[model samples]
Target: MTERRHDREFVRTFFTSPTAVEGEDDSAKMLRRAADLRGLEAPDVWVPDNEDATAPSMREEGAENVAEVVADSGADFPGEIHPRVVWHRDDPAARYRGFQQMLTVADPDRGAVDHIDGFVIPEVGDIDDWKKADEALTLVETEHGLDRGSLAMSVIVESGEAELAMRHLREEVGKPTNSLERLFLLVDGEVDYTKDMRATTPTGELPPWPELRHNTSRGASAAGLIAVDGPYDDIRDVEGYRERMEANRAKGMTGIWSLTPGQVVEANTAPLPPETGRWLLSAGDRRVELDDRDGAWAYDGDRLSLDETGDDYRLRVGGDERRLDAEQLREELLGLVEYVPSMSDVVDSMEEFEAARESGTGAIAIERAATLRLDGVDVEISSDRMWDEATYQAAMTPIRLFQDVYDHRPDQREELEERYGEDVVERATTVG
Candidate 1:
């Protein structure tokens, strides 16, 4: 596998604020502010937007603004910087303008090239169109005397053809002459996609294309690229943005395009596991929260009971009681206890697994026991989860992500210390 030039662990938020605005003395004000952000406010990937976000007449100045802002302040900014340049599949003039802009911003003398990670190409058509964009970046890199395949190319899937292009990426990227291996992110452009599909809603708002998001995630996974959902237009609707993120997270898409600093803060923090662990139990039609005490979850409510047989226990549900043994009880509780593991829990589990591994234990099963007061009976419950090498590696991802944020956002140290405590913060940064 080819190693990535950029060493980003996890990209939770991709912030794309407009680069240039008309009539403003400082055309790059937004871009400058984004570069100045530190701590929790900073996004994992920052895109200086010169495409749809900027006016057509101001795109040239917008490109200059991208180069100037990053050249001035990007060194201190602890995030990957990628400028979004304009490009259309059918418009040769627009493509040429975008190519020129890329050349301007990517020139080594501009000083921004050192901080720039790649370029984001929007409105791509098919696999061929995507290759054309890749080829353009190669030409730019060659002209600027940079290393070949250094500048990664990310594309926006705005049309059906562009969405379909993702299916062929695995095959196309394996070719010797193809630089599609440098592709980084597959971002969705919902607005234009809805237009292209002639999709309409009663309110005329863009419909939630869950299928598109799923395809993007699958494509990214197949090609080993990062998948990012498109921008949430209602910037003030914080809950709505979070709901959208939850849906995206379910589909294995953790990154989202952020339009403002506030959205960046929300997006950056949403994907990380919760700070504390809690349990939820499924009731008739709803989920009930169980109390956590002394590292175990307990519940004492509703119509339920437990009857002990000779060698098995019967758990009551509404009116049905099923006889279950200890192992079966563990399985039942495992299904019932939807626990969102805290950072501390993950770290502790990982440490235990590591120690076991050092001791030559190939695998281990962890047991979590709890007690429930159902009706008049006090019944004990437990769950066992198996952990192996593969499981440990998967669990290490969030820890690595935490370390990445802690390393990059020095300004957020105090806040992180407050949330996770000094010891946890230290271990989190050092453990993985």
Candidate 2:
């Protein structure tokens, strides 16, 4: 398996704050504020945006602000820093202007070289365009006597051609001539892509473009890079942002563009496993949260019937009726209601199974039993889930993600310790 790049791990949130705003005494006020963020509000990757977020007239000041603010405060910042630079494949003047801005920020005399990780190039075209961007960064590195391949390059996939160029990444990366190895992230920019495609919608809102997201994930996986979704324009729609993050998570894309610090907090927490466990009961076209009523999982919903047979229990849903034993009833109920495990629940189960495996047991069966009271009808149910080496490894994903978060966000350490408790926080951060 290709290991993830050392500098880029667990990018749950990508925040782009404007670099320089007019009329401010300090042009870098916004960038400085982002650099000072701590706890959950801090993003995994912070971009001092000089491209779209900064006005055309203020871009030069913005670059200077990025260099100055990052140089002054980058050491205290907990997240990775990458400034977005202006670039367009067909526009040479814009590309050179971007190049000049990159050189300005990357200059060792600016005192920001050590603090800067890389640059985010926007409006790239095909593979050649990518190579040109990479070559430009390479030249910038050499111009400053910085180490080759030291500056990472992340691009915004804004056009159809840029999207298609992703297929050549794995192959292009193997060639030793260029600094393709410095490529770190593949971020989607659906707004520009929509414009590029001339796509129209009745709602005047961006299409979900799930296929682009999936393609980005696949390409990132293929190239061993991180894939980030575009910005959620509706900043106040926290729930909507969460729903998109959830869907993106299912597609292997964890990081998303956060428009505000509040959005950053939501994005940061969205990828981690839930803090508490719950059961979600689903029937065709309907779903509801199943509550635990004093040691008995109870349901007060309509359209479900429970009846007792001499030696079995029968459950009728819609038009289907099935007879089941106690364990079978539990399994059936579980099949209908999925359990979303919390961080603690996952850890407990993994440790238990690990102990069993160490005690000479090749596999262990986990029992999940509960008393059901639907419409005041009491029916006891029980089921078993077998766990072995493969299952144990699967359970380690959340633990690994937890460790990554704990490792990267030292600013959030105390909060994490308090939320998960010291013991759990310790085991979670240290466990494989």
TM-score of each: 0.86, 0.93
lDDT of 2 by residue, 182-282 (tens): 88989999999999989989999998889899999898988889999999999999889999998998898989999899999899887777777777777
Which residue pairs collide, candidate 1?
none
Model 1: what TM-score?
0.86
Candidate 1 residue-wise lDDT, 1-432, digit = tens: 233334664578889888899999898888888898987788888998899889989899999999898899988887788899999988878788889999999999998899888999999998999988998999999999999889988899999999999999888985887788789999999999998899999999899999999999989887888889999999999999999999998887889999888999999888876788777887545677777655445667765555667788888767767898877865775676576788888888888898899999989997756665444444566667899999998888778778867776667678788888888777777764
Q: Highest lDDT: which candidate? A: 2
C-alpha RMSD for every candidate:
3.9, 2.4
**Where does the lowest 10-residue lDDT sum fall in candidate 2?**
1-10
For candidate 1, the 10 contiguous residues with the lowest summed lDDT are 1-10
